[model samples]
Target: MTSADRLWPFLCPSHPDHDDQSLNPVAADAPSLVNLECSRVLVCVAENDLLKERGWLYYQELGRRGWIGVVEIQETQGEDHGFHLYALGNEKAQDMIKRLAAFFNREMPPLL
Candidate 1:
């Protein structure tokens, strides 16, 4: 079982007054998400990383709520956490850098 599965209560704490004191910050702020006037989000996950599922889940949950202006998730197959950082000259690392630049340079869509 995943740590989240094992420590569900601690991660998503329940308060008597219904105020969330969740260990997961995203979960805590999920219900009141806002300030997406023209912002976009990009999430990168390493395929072989232990926390990969959580990263994807966070992206999916954000999209499902329609809170963020736009959310994108990219996966680097056969990679583990920090692979890009440690393997600077690797193809995947270079690709990641290019993607990041493109994402940063992309024009934001006009708010409707």
Candidate 2:
């Protein structure tokens, strides 16, 4: 297997029925919490990360459904998936860290 396949587990482990072709399947068939609710959502996604795109979508869906008070998306340019871990000392990683800190420090909307 290629490096990407080898690293898939660390990035996002595959589920037992992930191979099934379903658009909006039951929560039990998916890897997400049922009736999940959070006061704030901080999403850090690498711009060049394919895996993170799905996470971005999930957060967007939460925002659309008004389930999250805040949604933050940090797109780290010139970095791939797991850049923070693999691209330590890189400018992109440093920028991502700064953005994360800023997001955490900012005031969030009151929980609904």
Candidate 3:
């Protein structure tokens, strides 16, 4: 088996080189800032050497407007972007899922 096949089974279970394309148009616009007014917003960002450099700026912009409801940063020390997806059995991904679940539960409780 190839290394990517062995490492990231979910990303490309059958073909390691397959391209999966998905986009969020709303998240790509400047006016997308209004979307953060929700009761809670979970931002899962990795501490990639390059990506992490933008974290502070993102945090500052989001925090300054007081529009964000919740912010979570995953610090993957010595790791690069897309580590969670690459590391199939990564603890950070699991933890992030759990945290997101909790946040949704708290923010959007079930109807009585």
Q: Candidates' lDDT values, in order? A: 0.71, 0.60, 0.51
lDDT per residue as tens, model 3, 41-78? 45556655443544554555565655545555556565
Clashes of 3: 0
Ranking by TM-score: 1, 2, 3
Q: Is candidate 1 or candidate 2 better by lDDT?
A: 1
Error of 1 at 10 (Å): 14
TM-score of 2: 0.63
lDDT of 2 by residue, 1-110 (tens): 44434554554555332322132222335444334565566777776776565557666776555454656667677667788877769887777788777877887666
As for model 1, its CA RMSD to the true structure in angstroms is 5.0
Q: Count the backbone clashes (under 3 Å) in each candidate.
A: 0, 0, 0
Global fold similarity of model 1 (TM-score) = 0.70
| Candidate with more favorable, higher TM-score: 1 or 2 | 1
Best by TM-score: 1
TM-score of each: 0.70, 0.63, 0.50
Off by over 4 Å in 3: 1-29, 32-35, 66-68, 108-112
List the pairs of residues colliding in candidate 1: none
Question: Given candidate 2, what's the lDDT at residue 24?
Answer: 22
lDDT of 3 at 26: 24
Give the local distance difference test score of model 2.
Answer: 0.60
